[model samples]
Target: MLQDYTIKKQPTKTSKLIASIEFILVLLAIQGVLLLFNQEVPTSEVAQFRILANSNTAEDQRIKQEVQKKIAPLLDQAISQSTTQQQLHDRLQHLEPTIEQLAGEYANGSAVTFEHKAALIPPKRIGFAIQQQDVYDAYILKIGKGKGDNWWCALFPKVCYPEEATVTETEEEPVKFFVWEWIKSWFS
Candidate 1:
């Protein structure tokens, strides 16, 4: 004969409370692991490289690309030997004059200034890791007035470069409040 497997009694209040507490504990444990990963993956030791154009004009943007192409190789050579953030920054500082000269030449008369300093980077989700907005060591190259669109990447982590080290960015998903939603689901 076929068996009737349906529940004959609803769970008691105490049992329901126990189940909910267990679920919450599991969620907390998972969140703790995620927090640890976020803290370690995207580090403060990142070094950024940014090229800013004089204006938003096509000519200015073209000059920006030309500079980028020419300067990227020299940077690749300079930072390749460094194993730590301090070493990378020192190398960049040493290479500053050459970098400016190359960019100035590629800029076609546009005024160029190269600075290696601490700069603010907006929050970015590059590949699977989310990099929070913070100040980082950077090499900022300004063309002419330096008021236009800019091209930048975390040179240390290599977010925008493929052959360099590979990382990501292109519209990240928004953060979700899963705990609130989970609680509502239980009530419903």
Candidate 2:
């Protein structure tokens, strides 16, 4: 007498459940890694512009406003033409004498200084995005004492102006599968 035998392997219910759980954990880990990398993208590449008033007095405030008005158009023109941070810096440098002249006209002959440097800026809302407190390359126009309230805005992105500026909301990138949606699909 002779006999033939064959073997077949099938996954049990428990094994299938374990495999699904493992797959979900792996997906979640990958999502976390992607989020981490996304967060690491640099935000310090932008340039800023600031105007510091001489004092908080009514007259000084008026002078600051005047100076801002006179320089706003110049800044807008220069910023609009610039395509890079370095170009912005160079344009500001070239315009320093003109800026000082404009400030002196409104500042009653008070000395004004134009400086480009890295400075710690406070948190502020620029257009749509809220800029966090951090060090940034800034073009500062210091008037006389430079001890009063300051006006600031982004220069490289060209979002700053004396008037109210609006930023169109950008659409977010769509994710392939959200965690909640993935979980629901797995159970169903």
Candidate 3:
């Protein structure tokens, strides 16, 4: 006959201390990873960019003002010096083709739109014109040229081939067929 003996074991204080330390280390590591995942960049870099842009814009304006001031006297002197109607007529004649083209385009049914830099024109000067295609079809128009190089950078077509236009059959997802309407509607 064989008798089996079962001994009850008690956990030591050393084991408890080791378990507590391991728990604390795991918490610290978790916190560190969380902090890394949700890291916040300092605002000082954004502030610096804003300051630089403002300074450059101010400088550019100052330069333009100076140039205009310097040229004003010369323009006045040239006007005073010239007495011929022939000179004035010649200048007008040069611009006559552009005027005629603009007038012709306006007379025809076309989608016309213009872009300008921010806050250049007063709201009062902004007027809407609609060109009719038939009795019910028409497109709204706005006319103004952009002032800055940056404005035209995206607008102008380059030597490279244009990106392929995506076609959507769904009525909800409208595709652009006209340049002016597309651009105006996109920004607005």
Q: Compose the digit string of candidate 1's lDDT tens values, residues 1-188.
A: 99979878877766767888998899899988877766444556678888888887898888888989998988898778899888887888888888889888877788899887787766666655688767787789999988774344433444333454533445759877977777666666
lDDT of each: 0.77, 0.77, 0.35
Q: Could you give candidate 3's per-residue lDDT for residues 1-188 as a string of tens digits?
A: 87999988886666656766676688799988766665343222111000001112444434334433543453345445546645533443454354334523432332223211122111111123222211221111121221222222234322111342223223556666564464344345
Q: What is the lDDT of residue 86 in candidate 1?
A: 80
lDDT of 2 by residue, 22-123 (tens): 987998999887656543324577777888888878898898889999999999998999998888888888999999999988888788998888877766
Task: Give the poorly placed runs of model 3, Cα more than 4 Å off.
Answer: 1-6, 41-188
**TM-score against truth, every candidate:** 0.57, 0.57, 0.20
**Candidate 1: where are CA atoms >4 Å away?**
1-40, 150-188
Clash pairs for candidate 3: none
* Candidate 2 error regions (>4 Å): 1-42, 150-188
Lowest-sum lDDT 10-residue window in model 3: 45-54
